[model samples]
Target: MDTHTAATRYIGPTGMDPIFNRIANWLPKLGIDVAGGRLLAVRGRKSGEWRTTLVNVLTTDDGNRYLVAPRGHTQWVRNLRVAGAGEIRLGRKVEAFTATEVADADKIPVLRAYLDRWGWEVGRFFEGVTQDATDAELADIAPGFPVFRLA
Candidate 1:
């Protein structure tokens, strides 16, 4: 298979593939944070399935934590929304928090931060939307895309 397909296979279902999970589990020790700030565990919106996604952790100037899904329309994003809350595991500490979608204007800085962390591939994904689209508009395009803050 081509590289993209191979990568997709590895990241299958939010990097749940066995090998991917192993690597994901080890990444932090190596000093690379995969999901941005923390690892989140959420239930699937429609299937009632449980999933773990490593998302970028966003912090405001005032210190509140946020998680933004550039592809907000994805299933996991919806799941977090419907479920209203999820668990964030940072190293050995795990905490439960509510998830909220941030406004578009608010999302811009978060998206910028995400781009800074993940770079072009992520930035390009959000760039595809119109310049005028609200953060929510761009966010809505990808149902799984979301900006999650702590409860």
Candidate 2:
């Protein structure tokens, strides 16, 4: 996650990515759980229609749950800000909840935990930070990663 890599790696999903997400969204609907992945259905800010995407759920050590957007300023993030609440669906099971945006200063531990769990998938976005990274190091890159405290 060098500066150059971090600077360039987070281009957001493009090209075939949406197609892949559409397919991934199906597995959860089909009753197949993929690494705690779920279909996150949130109301679109402008369209007022449900926008669905695949997201991996993170359960912290304190029994709290979270959703981290490694890609900064993404559509889902923007929609969540307006909608305030959303649903996470896994097959027939769905959990409806509210989301609180975690402040950048408070995201170090959450970001660290996220990297520990899914860094292999999202590490590129962190600018080279890792789970073993120092608190100062993680804090330096925290703002780029948006975290939601779910309840």
lDDT tens readout by residue for model 2, 1-151 = 3544433333577778779877888998887987778889899999999998888889999999999988876789889989999999988998999999998789999988888999997777676779999999987776667789999
TM-score against native, each model: 0.61, 0.88
- Top candidate (lDDT): 2
| Tens digits of per-residue lDDT for model 1, 1-151 | 3334322221223534567656675654344655454577787777777777666666767787777665435556668879988887766677788877775446565655555666544555554554445656544443334577777
lDDT of 1 at 10: 19
For every candidate structure, what is the RMSD over all alpha carbons to the true structure, in angstroms? 7.7, 3.3
Q: Ten residues in a row with the worst lDDT in model 1? A: 3-12
The positional error of residue 146 in candidate 2, measured at the CA in angstroms, is 0.9
Worst 10 residues of 2 by lDDT: 1-10
lDDT of 1 at 19: 74
